[model samples]
Target chain A: MTTVIRELGDEQRELVLNMGPHHPSTHGVLRFVLHTDGEVMRKAVPEIGYLHRGLEKIAESTTYPGYVPYTDRVNYLEAMFANEAFSKAIESLSDIEVPERAQYLRAIAGELNRIASHNITIGCITMDLGAITPFVHLLRERETINDLIEALCGQRVTHHYVRIGGVAYDADDNWLKQVEKFLNHFEAIIEELDNLIVYNEILVKRMADVAVITADDAVGFGLVGPNLRASGVDWDLRRDMPYGIYPKLDFDVPIGAGEKGTVGDCFDRFVVRVRELKQSCRIIRQCINNIPDGDIIGNVSRKIKPPKGEVYSCVEGARGELGVYVVSDGTEKPYRVKWRSGSFSAMSIIEHISEGLMIADLVAVIATLDVIAPETDR
Target chain B: MTSEALIDYVKGLLGDKTKWADPEAGDNFLTVASEDWKNICQTLATDKKCSLTYLRNFTGTDYPEDDEIELTAHTFSYSEKHGLIIKTRISREAAVCDTLSKIWPAAIWYEREIFDLLGVSFNNHPDLRRILMPEDWVGHPLRKDYKQQETYRGIPTTRPA
Candidate 1:
């Protein structure tokens, strides 16, 4: 149906505003075709792909080892998760063995990456809800984790730390010590954030019961990560489809059963990510304790050619399921390489969730969905 | 679940529409006719035994050299049944498939994406706009023989080969 925007007066015509593919508050280069009558939105249809780098097409040309750097650029917030997803998918496709030490190291970095990503999720959600303090506070903690990534791979945000088979560098003594110190402070900050955002009444007024989606719609729409779990569909790739050392880790997959108001709203989505932060910490602590010493890199085939078959390996990305489908013709180059991006599902929620709300609320909804534009565009 | 039973079960449900045993259980193919797209998806999804609720992704690959366009639907049942990925191809002429967006609303953008990058049109998509590329863009870039000389807005690009 063509959305009909009627004018309030002859002088005051309905305005169709171009939000942006360059607005920083848009989170990334996400443009919105927002149909509004001044402040209230009639319809807000998101226009994506302003930052489309076409990584999947690029992967078909690059070697298996050459694809690692590309994943770093896919999801800039959760760089390690994208890296791990690519590396793990290649490892699974080739049936290469990653050592226990490497696996443990991968788990630590992955969970830390999850924490950093969650911090952004919670921080940005709160900021979008008009609480600026939480955004800065959360970023202050996210930078330390970025420092750890920098120590490993020399770059912070776009970390090329994970290779095809295993992590590029092992967590040395100092790195472990730094991680332990951060974990202590991280716990306290999370507590403060809970008090500030989760329990706050003003945040609840803006978030709770806004843009509610049912469990049926959640599954039907294939919402993943905290979004799916927030809607009460217990489909986590880590536990259900075990990859790496996640199955061994002791933690609960947190769900949002409408603590404040109802499931599948902005607050519940934020709560799910907040709860996941604690669970991610639990997994990281277990990883730190049981981490054995061994080689970091695994035995990836030199030529890195798989059988003339298709293999898709999906890991539990910080946002959702991140998979890479490789169609190799028993050659160094792949016939096709498709990156199953997390944000694709996250952004798809816009179709169902953006129907009836103010334009500002639409931004709030997108921020709560926590989609990375590069990941979606790629 | 045993591969044999999983294979047999899928065969019974899909009948002639799916080729279960022909492609091994390790992320391989089963051809699907364009007519059978929605039924096959609904069967794979709604059947309580095979609650293939989680859609991993839907992507298409264009093989201009082979004159075949491939579309793959990677799905898994969350209620502890099985995971099956349907791989199908269409001869370059009738490269259209009925979209499963009605069955799985998540397929909206995904089908649009396949439509966007690979030019595999999804018949009856609600809003089949170019998702990742500008609306005015000419040819799909992911096709094997496709070119990316000028962008959607007619801005010419020069990059070292």
Candidate 2:
């Protein structure tokens, strides 16, 4: 009466494994079809659009003011930057004027947002690179910035602090002082981070020359932000194409050291963001003192449409160059609204860049790209 | 360095071939044939003044009633300090265009999106797969001809097309 049970064969051979769209690590709703040859990745085809809500198409249907909330969720990582770009779009379209004070305040918050975003990227990079402790350490510091954002905008992550013409409100003196103090303390902490990871022999060996993307290929891939610059594209929307009070602000736009990939590698990307944190601190300090006094948001054109014309508004977002292309037909709602997202370019290159890499290295590559999946899908 | 000045100079480069470069207010745009978008993009990208390396976006708006698909390519020139929004329309029957991915690598995803939602095919895109839609999804959602009472996922949407 004994039954013989046979073990199923094909235990350790080549097989296709699906990771996400919801598996804790793909971040948010990202599906990666991983073809692995025993832990070594044969192919990593990231199937996105699982979360595409047709945001651009939706924008054309909604009124100008109504689309602000939608913009807040476009990237989700850099909501403040998204809000800024969206507001800039409306402002440019209708010629809604923003005053000097509002511009300075926008810069201040924009700089703070830059720091927050960089911290996330840094923490996430180390976290992916087998250093989980640094991720928590980075987030611990980032929480303070989040608290400040919450106090300023009444929400933590998706702080809809920006409006059409300018910011929704202004920061008090106490908040500005706190921001300044945070900036100074952040520099010392970042140095400690450098000591921890930047010069560490293990981290460098793991990261250096891992995923190399040439500058030419980077351009072909339409990469932007730190990812693009890391590959030797001397282009930054903030510095090269100035908007808000960024033109007046004095800070060095940090170029990638290029010690990693050809021009765009993971290590240089880390270097760029780390350097940007310091630059953002400098920009914020200057903004704190130079901030003027006036109305925050102006009267945006609410009821009617702009004209039977089109406008493209671009701004240097935390991730990359975020643009909103609007086609109006002299109505309440836009005839067409397309978001030229920076992440769009970066994400598109995954096919070209992610081919034939290891699983652990693939995750590292994903972090270096610094693309929020929602932004890519949306 | 202004858009108008840049357009004026570009017109000079074309030497009377530059037709339909309409300058409306601050925006100066040109409408070329869908087939010519890639070559034009290459010229814009490589030309000394119009170093429009950044393919700002590639999107299309559908008008089923008009039986046309208006495709737009927004390019920016860092050297000239101006942006040029190029627009062209193709017959609804043939919603096809040359892929600008070669001239501008950024256009790959954009072309995929245009292919995914708008149902516009890029002739030679390296990986012209669906971007914001699933691999086995039914129809392009952004197409004016396509009617969607609700999305494929049936995610309770109150907004109408």
TM-score of each: 0.93, 0.91
Best by TM-score: 1
Regions of candidate 2 where Cα sits further than 4 Å from its true position: A1-15, A35-42, A260-262, A301-304, B20-26, B78-82, B149-161
What is the C-alpha lDDT profile of model 1 across B1-161, one tens digit per residue? Answer: 55456667778877777754243323655667766767887887887777788776788888777798988888876676467777677766667888888878888988888888888877888988788877778878788888875543555576547
**Residue lDDT tens for model 1, A266-323:** 8888888988888888888888888888898887666787666677877787888777
TM-score of chain B of each: 0.85, 0.84
TM-score of chain A of 2: 0.92
The Cα error of candidate 2 at residue B50, in Å, is 3.3
Per-residue accuracy of model 2 over A1-378 as CA lDDT, tens digit each: 122223336664556777776764566778777766767776777777877888877876788788888888887768888888877776776778898888888788777777888888888888777788888888888888888888788877887888888888788999998887887888898899988887677777767887788877776666777777788778888888888888888988777766654446678877888888888888888889888778887876557467667777777777878877777777888777788777667767776776677787877778878868788777
Q: Give the clash count for each candidate.
A: 0, 6
For each candidate, the alpha-carbon lDDT, in order, equals 0.79, 0.77
